[model samples]
Target: MALARRTLTPFGLWVFGAAASAPMVVLAGGIVATYATTRVTALPLTFLLVAGTVAVLAVGYTAMARQLGHPAAYYGILANGLGRGWGVAAGMVALVAYNAIQTSLFGLFGATMAAQLGGAWWVWAGIALAVVGVMGVRAIVLSTRVLAAVLTVSLLIVAAFVLACVGRPAAGGLSWEGFDASGLAVSGIGGAVAFCVAAFMGVDAPGSFVEEAIDRTSVGRATIGGVVVLGGVYALAAWAMGVAVGPGSVAEAAADPAAGLPFAVLERLGGWWVPLAELVLIFAVVTSMLAFHSVVARYVFAMAREGVLPAGLAQTGSAMRVSAPRGGSLTQTGTATVVVGAFALAGADPIGVMFTWLSTLGAMGLLCLLLAASVAAMTAPARVRGPQAGAWEWRLAPALGVLGGSVVLALMVGNVGSLLGAAPGPMYPFFLPAILTATAIVGGVWAGHLRQAKPEVYPGIGRGIPKTHAVPDAINVSI
Candidate 1:
């Protein structure tokens, strides 16, 4: 079943992108984590710089997305621009990445709520997982409303914090040292940039909803606009954090108790805002999870509809006469439950282990996908990319995007130790790339198998549907 069309506006699309970034969570967890892990106090500058690079990526990304009407953005772009095999690789990576990122939030969600309420971390995560699962199978518009509402409150909290920090600057009045470029010259700045880039990870989400958006162009607007708006929010928040505790002391303050740093700052500077901020942050993470869950369900739906996976996964449920990807949503819910349970059984640190590891892994894979898509956009034929194929957006922007994306990817990978807190070792810090490589290899092999066993379905791997492809009897169920 297809997603409901004409249900999302430019504003709604922007909300999906922004909410997935989880503004409060980013300000609280991500920004402070960057300061502590990277020991870089110029995080405000890092966010601004990363935003510029991400905007470059959006140029080619949106252009490619405009050409394709598929629900799975990265998969369609890769499959159409490159080949069936490459598209399969992109699709597998995307599927794993989005799921990792979505489920990763549960760690933070559980921990935050467990502190607020009386329960084990996983218990709160399970409650949210159930709530998100229900919402995931509802109408797209319904979920968007939830995201928009929660994100609005989160943004307000963000604004409140920014105002309070700027109002009560430490020592010698207000200072601009956080924006100083000289601070970025440190060894671990790449780690700071990587985390900052993660803060904007969801901005590309509008592309995933292109087919559901009221206007395809709105996807472009929302994606690019999200990058700009989020950049400003993050920069301001990071700067405010530095201002609250003199810039030079920002690293020291953040490192003392990194995860609690934002709350401490808020409690000190804003007096009474800490309670509300923490409450909203937990909900903000939920909204973020909902946004990513919605995106993942669509990806599964798109792949299934094309007969790439079990065709039964393409089945739908209805809300307000609009179809929701029921089978896909349920599949994601089940997968998430299993992962969350395993972590809980092992007594993992919700924030340190689950959130830190999986989210970064997701971000890393996505950066690779972005780089590949940029190359695909630059190389695709004029006919395949449609009328505006030869424009600067299709040509120059993607070229620059590839360059910028590659540098960012290199920096991020080079500083993996700081990002993961892994000591000098071969097994720990190297797990992410190894997993991605293994996934790509598996995808390539799967594509080859499909080429021989299901030649009829091969041609339509990335185009959304197949005119002649037959569903495999073993996995295809009539629902």
Candidate 2:
């Protein structure tokens, strides 16, 4: 069999990097959850936590990336600093979490479009998943290009919707006066922030292709730049909806922002354009689901290849030649399928239940990964401490990152029960994070002490990691 090429030009890298992060802007179900909170609670505190957390994540990620060098380097550093066991453990959690989220979104895509298509939602979901899976199992360039086309068209449609609503009346159309932040609750504020933070979660994914990024030195810049683009898009989408419909009615409209708000506005401006806007809204969700599914599957493949999970999860597809690890990939697909099946069984609203759970879990996992990464950053390279290290690692940076991530994690975990009302696996709040953290700790202890037993593998732990080059490179990447 011919091996699929692993080549990714610098431009291709940027596109993939941006597309990987694009899902955060579109398919992010967390925004719906946050809107519900704002409508039910206070908006000011929600704004503070949401704004504050992303700002912190941005700083921490940038500083930590400087030391780690590249995406894989970040993972490698975690393995080296925390122990290989921990690296595998963190990688596993990330892999599973990404797939679950992607799969859940698949259900949403199916159900939403099904309603419009006048067919079974699961059928739509199956169709959507099939498309995503095929793309996911193809070359990175192919996947990125498809995602870019979907993303650009989807965005243009939304932009048009927003512009059409500019001068509409408050009663039935655009109403900027309703952007209030007075009703937020302390818990609700934290919850909203947790959800919004999910929008910025995929910025680090492109780093997975560090070995293939056009310019290694540019990885950090590109990653950070992606975050900024995500933030702006999210803010615009939120503001446009918040202003047009008013926070008061966000509840009923929360189910689908693009369709709910933008469609309403379009109906007022040019009634004939309403259907077009709604179609675009549907496509946006589809694009997001496809984008997320591809990246998450890739994550599973990478982790399995590194032995974080069983060997099976890291198996690459014949076409993509970058398939997930064997056991990990199976686990990812299984988890997603189960969730979608359950939603189908419960006859529950796919977008509300499955989407919420996936986004919530994604949020929690993201915080956990950041915390682990930060700790690793702080602990790595202990033997070479000095201004050089201080300037590079920003030990303080990771420390702060941990603190910031911890706060977000705590808020989300604490309210998991409250948010979901104890349905969807009654033990989720306590169990999921415990599983994630425990897995990492166990892996770390195992890897760190393996030197006493498996001495051979121990010595080469840091070798071949994308970030660690014996010679100088342009990406200025470290990990």
Candidate 3:
């Protein structure tokens, strides 16, 4: 079946991209950790820096999107710009990175929900996996709505918390310390920047839905909008944290991030919404998981259609041609279930094993993907007829993205122990890169085999472009 084209509006794409960021989780959990590590009152500034970097990358990224009109994310850009072999390698990396992210969320969700609702963590994880699976099989519109609603609630809670902080600032009294660079000179600034960058990881997610956007322009707008919104929201919340507890004492206050320090600040500031905010955070994580689920499914579908995976995995829903990747969704769901169940059976600590290790690995892998994509954006073939970005936007911005992403990747690797919330060890630090390298080698070898044995499918590695099929036209924009 042919996929539908132009089924999603700008707002839907924005929500999907932004929700994948899990703003509330970052505000409530990630920021606190950053603060504890960096002891930097200017954590908000770090967020702005990260956002600005991404915005620059988007200038070139969106330009490429307009030119290529492919919806397979990095794989498409890599294939068209770099080569089929590199694109195949990227596809393998993306699948593993996104799946790691999605599965890692279950650990956080299960632990949080179990703490609040009085149940086994595995029970909560299992339930979430099942629910998200169902949602993943539904129309993209449905998932967008769910994400939009949850994101709205989460943002409102953050807004309320910020207001309370501003109303009752600590001894320093709502200073602009967080904006000053001097305040960021902590012992772990590298780790802090890496985490901040991790928090902005989903800025490119909107591009994955370009095939379904109401207009190709919507993809660019949605991506930029999501980046700005997440950046602004995170900055505000982090600033509020600094204000509420006094910048100097932030590290001490957040010494125990697992204790939900940010929400505790809200409670202390006469904000009676702590419990409600916690609930919103749970929903935020769920929405984030669902968003990543959708991203992974699309990758699977795109690869399947290109013959990198089984073609059956590309099957969409019958009711809507551009609807969900039902087969891919089911496949991801089953994989997550088995992984989560195995951890449960082993009586593992959900937070330590599933959340920390997997999420850190995913974050590092994503950084690598972003770096490759930025290079692709700079070198990709441009369209002769369509709108073209200026030289600075197309060239300089992607160059900067490549530089910045490389630095962050290095920092993440050096601070792998801190990122994983564990002591430094040879295995812990080296495992992720080894795995990524191995996958890339496997994918390249596989692509070479396909080129030799099945030349017809080799060139179409990331071409989720338009053609006649059982899918709807709305979801098949040309590559």
Candidate 4:
């Protein structure tokens, strides 16, 4: 079955992309943690720098969006520019990365619910899995609506907090300390930047649903819009957090961020909102997982249809020109269930083991994918000649994206132990890189075999279902 065409407007696409970023979680979790690690009054600066870098990346990304009609953006870009071999490698990395991200959230969701409500982590996880499974097998519109509602409520709470901080600063009063350049000159600057960039992890996810967007242009618009909006929200929230806690005490507060920095601030400014904010946070994580699950399901559907995986996995349920990848959704949900169950059965610390290991590993793999995609964006224009591609969009912007992604990758490598909340060790530092390298090698070998034995399938390695089998006009039009 084929995905429905023209089902998502620009707003829907933006909401979908932004939901994947999980603003509430990043604001309350990632930003606060960055202050603790770097001990630098430069949270806002780090966010701005990361935002600018991603915006540069989006220039090429959006440019390429017009040419590559495939839902698997990273894989298609690589295939069109680098080679089908690298495309296969990207596809492998994407499946692993997206699945890791989706599954990792189960730990956060379950643990948070258990702490806030009264239940076991596994029980909450199982319940979440069931809800997500139901949502995942429905039409895209249904999921987007849920994402939109969650995002709207969560962001409203965030906005309220930011306004409160601005209106009532702590002891030091309103200050721009976080944007000060000198404050960024710290020992863990690289790690801080890496963490900041990771906050925008899913900004490009909307490209995966271009085929379902109301207008092809909505894909690029949604991508750029997500980056800008998420970046602004992160930067503003971090700055407000600094204001809420006196600038002098911000670092100390961040040291135990997970202990409830945002809650503490809200309690001080608007005690009544604390309960509401907590509830919003829970829903935010749930929606984020649902959003990421949808992304993973699409990747599996796209890859399976292209013959990279079992054809049965590509099966979808279709009605009224809309299709839901029920098979792919079920496959991903099953994988999450198994992984979560294993962790619970092992009696492991859900937060320490499941969340940390998988999230950090997934972040590393995604950075590698982004790095490869940046390269593809820079080179693909030479061969495909996208609609309005120019030196700025195709060359300079992508060049910057490459540099930025490489720096973040290097930082993540050096600080992997810290990011994983583990003690420094050779084994911990090198494990993720080694796994990624092995996956790349395996994908290359498979692509080579397909090239020699199944030439027809090889050409469509990143393309979705073949045109003959796809619903009419279901594929995106080249801009």
Candidate 5:
């Protein structure tokens, strides 16, 4: 079948490309910025680890681009390398993980907006949920442009606010002494790294845009450029927040991880501008939500087309408005609705629930994907590795990156109580184990049912994976 295509303008593509990085930046940088300055001190090791992990993503991403030729190249590589089951599993992880992060942020945004505006809690929650509905099912380009404009304006306002504080440095404040991490928790390092990496989630955005690249080289160039830009943005933004607010003030700045940094800085500037700052941050969060929804929608659409998922997910908008994965759009929309509606119905605090469930879980899933993708990059053939071949990116770098990331991933699961502050009760580590197992079991059962009920339609499971194979020691990445 001929693949569906969208009629997005060049500008729209650029917007999608840029906007895709916004949520990750805020999630990674803004949220962490809050913790770094206030809750923790300037631990060189912590900052270095945070910066190094992000920098490593750039290196690995560039290597993949050199080898793969385009973002879609991973689709083929993964399908060939991991077998169908694993590939589909990878997609499951990505879709659910990304949605978790996006959904979690919705709660955070609602709570912050409500507090800043002093409005009815339900009204703000309703508005945030409403935005999700509108943005969730729309064509990618339309959503991207709107998100780009919002991110640009919101970020500018934040930058100005941060810079002003630096220029007029508060009395007896702004000194290097506060950078010390002496009293910080060694145990918290893993948690910090976990969130630090969340900001770089959009590094994979360029892969999704492979089809739109002017050429193969453009795909490679764009991928490299995107990662570099993302790392720089996070590092600089975090450092700025540290300088202006001091490391001791992160908890005070935004007691909640989901709170916007600009709103806190605005309060410092003057009490009167609090509402304005809140509104600006709301725009940023909303834009971030829409941008991520579009990105994840494409992943679902792709998985469907490949037969890893129901074909309906692969369906494009009527008249080729977008080439979103078929059958996936509805799934994506449905998931978002349930996530948004569940919290609303339960009367739970959006930010608190978001912090506890969606964002943290999403971070876990994304980390898994990154480690898997790094292995894919390293194991790819030299012909495809291009210039980055034989370099650190293809050699010790990915190996170490995966090892480091996996360790952090394990810590996140192990320390879930610390991060989310929720006891597993009798389950201990069983909560994560149960959730992951259930998701995998459901996905596996669905795949099996598809095989039995509609053998003809089943896209064969990834290349090496047998229908009933065991999970291998080596990481797999395709679905």
Candidate 6:
């Protein structure tokens, strides 16, 4: 069954995209880790630079969405643009990447929740898994509202961090050293940029909601708007951190493991803020997981409907008058349980195993998809691209996106060990790319089999539905 279309307004789309980015978690963990790992003080500038690149990527991404009008994101785009074989390959990569991201957060959420409240980490993970599965089958409006409330508090907490840091100037007197473009030209900048880029991993999530948005334009607005809003908040908070410790010492201060930079600064406020921040950090991670659950489930639904995977996964459950993709949600929940359980059985570190390894894998895979998407936006058949497409949307923006994506992809590759924290080894660094490559190969082989045995279905891998079943473009616009 298709997701309930026109059920989400532009604000709902924004909330979904922002919740996926998880602003508070980025501030508390991503910023601290970036500074420590890269020793780069110009994170504020790096974030803005990366955001501009992503914003450029979005220009053609949304234009492609308007032309295709399909629920499946990369899968649909590649299928229409590159042909069914490439589309199915992308579908496989997307499924694995998104599911990895969705389940990996269980490690962080479980660990954080256990630290604050008493319980086994896996036990907490199981509980949240069940909760998300249940919520996933309900009317999406319910999930949107739940996420909106959680995201609101998370952003407020981020704002508080920025405010507290700005209130107290260090010896440098409100230093803007973190914003220095020259600071970014130094060594280790690639690792810093890669880390900052990971913080915005879910920004493209809005494209998946295109079929469900109240306005088709909201897809681009939400996608680009999410990047800008997230980048601004991250830049402001990172800069404020430099202000609190003096920009020159920001990287040095972050290096002191015991100090816990941002929290250390917030503690000086000397009230309930730190405790509140901790509690909300747990919620922020859960919200991020939930947001990813939505993305993964939709990918499952999109592919399943086309006979690429099991068709049963396309089934939807009607709860309170809205058709929710319960089939897809259940599949992801079950898969996550097995993956998380295996890690637990091996006595793995939640942060080291599930969180670090899986999140890094997912981040690299998503970056690959983003790059492929820009190329597809330009290469898709002109007939499928629609006659209204312009030079900027059809060509220039996507070309720029390709250049930017190539640079980011290169940085991430060069710094893969840093991102995964892999020890020196023959194959450890190549692990992520290897997994994605094998998965894509499997998908290609499956497509070849389908071409031989199920010729009809093979031809329509990425196309959403027959034209007869589609909502007209004029009607979609009016809605």
Listed per candidate, the RMSD to the true structure in angstroms reads: 4.6, 5.6, 2.8, 2.7, 7.4, 2.7
**Candidate 6 runs further than 4 Å off:** 423-427, 465-479
State the weakest 10-residue window (summed lDDT) of model 6: 470-479
For 1-479, candidate 3 gives per-residue lDDT tens digits of 34456667888888888898888988877888788766767788988988877776676666666556665677777787688899899888988888888899999999988888889999999999989998898877677878989988988888888888888888746678888998667667777887887788776788888767768877878888888888988988888887887877778888865545777767855656787888888889999999999888888887887788888998888544456677778989988998899889999899878887778777777778878877887777655114645767567878998887677778778777677676656566678788889988998999999999998999777665656644444553222
Q: Stretches of candidate 3 above 4 Å error?
A: 257-260, 268-272, 319-322, 383-389, 424-427, 469-479
What TM-scores do the predictions have? 0.94, 0.77, 0.94, 0.94, 0.77, 0.95
Of the two candidates 3 and 4, the one with more favorable lDDT, higher being better, is 4
What are the lDDT scores of the predictions, listed in order? 0.84, 0.56, 0.79, 0.80, 0.56, 0.82
lDDT string for model 6 (329-443, tens) is 8898899999999999999999877898888888888888878888888888878777777889878999999999789888987888777766546567777889999998898
- Once superposed on the true structure, which residue ranges of model 5 sit more than 4 Å away at CA? 1-38, 43-48, 58-77, 116-138, 170-174, 177-187, 215-227, 248-264, 267-273, 318-327, 381-393, 423-430, 441-479
Model 4 Cα lDDT, one tens digit per residue, 1-479: 56667677888878877998899989777887778777767878888888887777777766666567667777777877788899988888887888887898899989999988878999999999999998898878778888998999989988988987887788647898888888778787877877876788887788888767768777778888888888888989999989888777788888973647877767756678899888888888889888888888887887788888788988887633467777789999999999999999999888888987788778788778877777887778454755556788678888988898777678778888777766656575578778888888888899999899988889877654345544554442211
Candidate with top TM-score is 6
Candidate maximizing lDDT: 1
The residue-by-residue lDDT of candidate 2 on 88-168, one tens digit each, is 566656655666557667766777687877787887877766665555555555666666676676566656655654554
TM-score of 1: 0.94
Model with the higher TM-score, candidate 1 or 5: 1
Worst 10 residues of 5 by lDDT: 470-479
In model 1, what is the error at residue 104, expressed in angstroms? 0.7
lDDT of 5 by residue, 1-479 (tens): 11222234334444554565564346334455436433554432344565466446445544664344322333434434444445455656666777887777667776766776787555675676676656656544456567767767655655666565565553446655333456445445655555555555554555554443333344434544555555555545555565666655654654554555645565666786666655665676777666666667666655555566666666654322433333444565578667777777888876656545676677666666667767776666655566545668676777777777777667667666545655546455335545655665566566667678878645654321123211222121111
Judge candidate 5 at residue 172 and give its lDDT.
47
Kindly give the number of clashing pairs for every candidate: 0, 35, 16, 0, 23, 0
